[model samples]
Target: MWKRGVVIPGARMQRALEHPGTRRFSLTLLAGSDAAMRVQDEILLARLYNELVVAGRIHKTTRRNRFKGLDRIIVEVLGRELPDVPEIALHDVGASSGVTTLELWKTLLSVRPGRAHASDYYANMLLVRCEGHPLVVACDEEGAPLQFTLGEFVFSAGQRESLFRPCNRWLQARARARLPDVARVIAARKEGRTLPSGWSVEVVALWHPACRLAAAADARFTLGRHDVCAVMSPRWHFVRAMNVLNPGYFSPERQREAVRALAGSLLPGGLLLIGRTREEADSSNVATLFRASSAGLEAILDLRGGAENKELVLEAGKRS
Candidate 1:
């Protein structure tokens, strides 16, 4: 079974800084949901204190705002090709409040409608919440594209008054009909009789095309202190700020350097998504200007301690 949210203890975080491996961080726009936004704030604040003040880092001035780029990158990546049977993880480097942890879970469940695999190494905890019955049908890769896809789906929580309110409508009658089958699917996964190693699949109604298109673009530009409410989602897992700080203002040269650093921390097949403005549109050309910054660097630094080398996703780089 894949490990879920695990928050690093303060002592461990400190020890990690001393480790030789690269550190990962990310900055992206705030989520589009209320729960996600609230959670992100708490996570960002906590990271700022632990990473900046405690560690005496330089980007202290905008530590709280650095995650914007990471945010945009991740949103853009997922937006481009959301996993139908996807396994997503976000490392919260400066996760003081752990709000980012909570929001990540909410978004996975609410927005795309699927089961989530979460891990919070820092907290040393893992949880799997099954919402709206998820059906997992399998197939050989060559047989039928893994028998699952990453996209939006309709859900039906049954009760007219649901915890998700109207959004619960994302649930569908089909899901309700398959409730029995979905139960079996869940049971099989837990017993390791169905799901493959590190894989989960759920069927959901098609996600809104507009939202899909927007997700394709860099999402970091939309996140801000006032836009924290945008982070909410039903997918529950160990979520946190992409990185502790946003590097939107760094110079082109520095931004590229930061991206290199962040990319070093990601795991194999892992992603570092974030938002950033076009350089040509940037007027001041200040290293700290959000409009003209490198999304890759910002996202990498925000991730909590872990395997620092996996892959990188930048606006300047390929969206895939």
Candidate 2:
């Protein structure tokens, strides 16, 4: 099934698999995959974060509090305004790592046969060639995959000072060193390859606890890849586009197109909730609700802990 962190074969991977020339390619990268992790074959920062979680520096629970205000908006505004609503057909788009939808099933699915669906564009299947990366296989002198056990490595000042260490640990540490310069590395790649700054990391998976729990909780909670301006599903009662259609990531025209699609994806009298989370998982988020009507997607309410809705209304007016 579509389990988060567990990638299933998709169009990108299928294309690679069907081709004869570059068939060794495997994997569809996670949506918005960290650029730093693509340089080397290890996710050092993620590992460090995982370490923090283990040490109690980080807590790994579904931060359901983020959606509390959105929930209120749903019940008070849409539930009351609609007057004749029977069920809610909802979609949470741009749901990064599925973290925003965690613990949502309790209120969404279990509440007397509720109807809602979620969406996200997971980084596409990532294709990794195992030959270059030593961790995936053990090669003999002739460079053939061989039977293996624990892998060893040497980490020290020099040939004389080198100390033996486990290969996995060394790789993990090597990954951390590249974190600070990753943004620069991405810029360099975009400009040109002639510059000397070149390194890569490989992310085989994204470990999202929220998505996993949601998938296991109910089969109705669908997970799939969707670009905001190009979602090809039928109309929904409500669509929540969070942290996706910001001006920084998309140009004005592109943002307008995305807004058009979001509005079009809603049924008449349906609600469209849009927002961006500012800091950590705090409630310092900015959200606005627009209800689809004959006048087009009309801004109906400015949500709590959200920015002024005038800005949202202005944007919608420009598009309208």
Candidate 3:
């Protein structure tokens, strides 16, 4: 049976960071280095976020410029539909890592200025202090740790040299087998019971520094944790949900519930954008822009092709 690598002491890692010679060496082991955390480097940020996604086994995945062409068209429609509106309140549901949310916000600014709120089901990162060994964890909306892994960072001397190696099928299988222990550790922490030496865990926010900076620097951009299936108060003038409501991810009933919630969140006459992108090199998008009304959602624009589940959206709208 494969075993988890021994955990290196957090005190030792801290000491390594304090020294000039070892600082660079220590930084190499971290998922997010000090410089990478402080700066807004898109490529570096995406890589760091992807690491968490893989380790946590979270299904939410997104990429930069994934909706490039579609976003411009959506903005154009907004300009024409809500012409006299000075400012639009926009909300992007299931905005993983929020990199693309910023992209859409910048595009919206070209035509009109608005406040943009980016939300996701798993929006928070947990910095788990395990005994003296530090582990970074990603959490669900309820603040429970999604998953944990020894492979997330260089937690032991054995991992230091092999850290950069690709995790093959065998390694992934072993990681999956070890999840029970990860859960045990989390439970012990939550119950306030004493953990075995080197196994004790403490959790805290490790929110990406770039996300914090973006929200602070721009009054218009904000981030939050939200589940798409949950009902929300009507507030936003425009809501965008991309690559989230999929037939593969949710049952038809659940999709209808999510659509109802999304529709209910829109202000009267507000617009709702729903779509998916093909994984082809061109990243072609199939989407529909809907005008929310008391009667139901009226499809105003179809890009490339209408949304794959456009009928489900319309059906949900009718019942809403």
Give one digit per residue, the lDDT tens place, for model 1 in 1-320: 11111132245435534552322111111112332223333333343222222121222222323344444444545545445435554443333333333344345444554322222212111111244423322221111211111122212132232444343333333334444543454566557596433444332211122222333453411111211113223232222323332354344554445444334444333444333223245411111211112232233332233212213224433322
- lDDT (10s digit) by residue, model 2, range 199-302: 44233333354455566677766566566788455568778876666555556776667777887788777877777666555546688788777777667777
Report lDDT per candidate. Answer: 0.31, 0.48, 0.65
Write one digit per residue (lDDT tens) for candidate 3, span 34-137. 54355354443443444444223334457777888777887888888888888989999888777678888889998787889999876654434445433433
TM-score quality measure for candidate 1: 0.26
Ranking by lDDT: 3, 2, 1
Scored against the true structure, residue 228 in model 3 reaches a CA lDDT of: 87
Note the residue pairs that clash in candidate 3. Answer: 10-132
Q: Residue 288 of model 1: what lDDT?
A: 22
Between the candidate structures 1 and 2, which one is better when assessed by TM-score? 2
Error of 3 at 205 (Å): 6.4
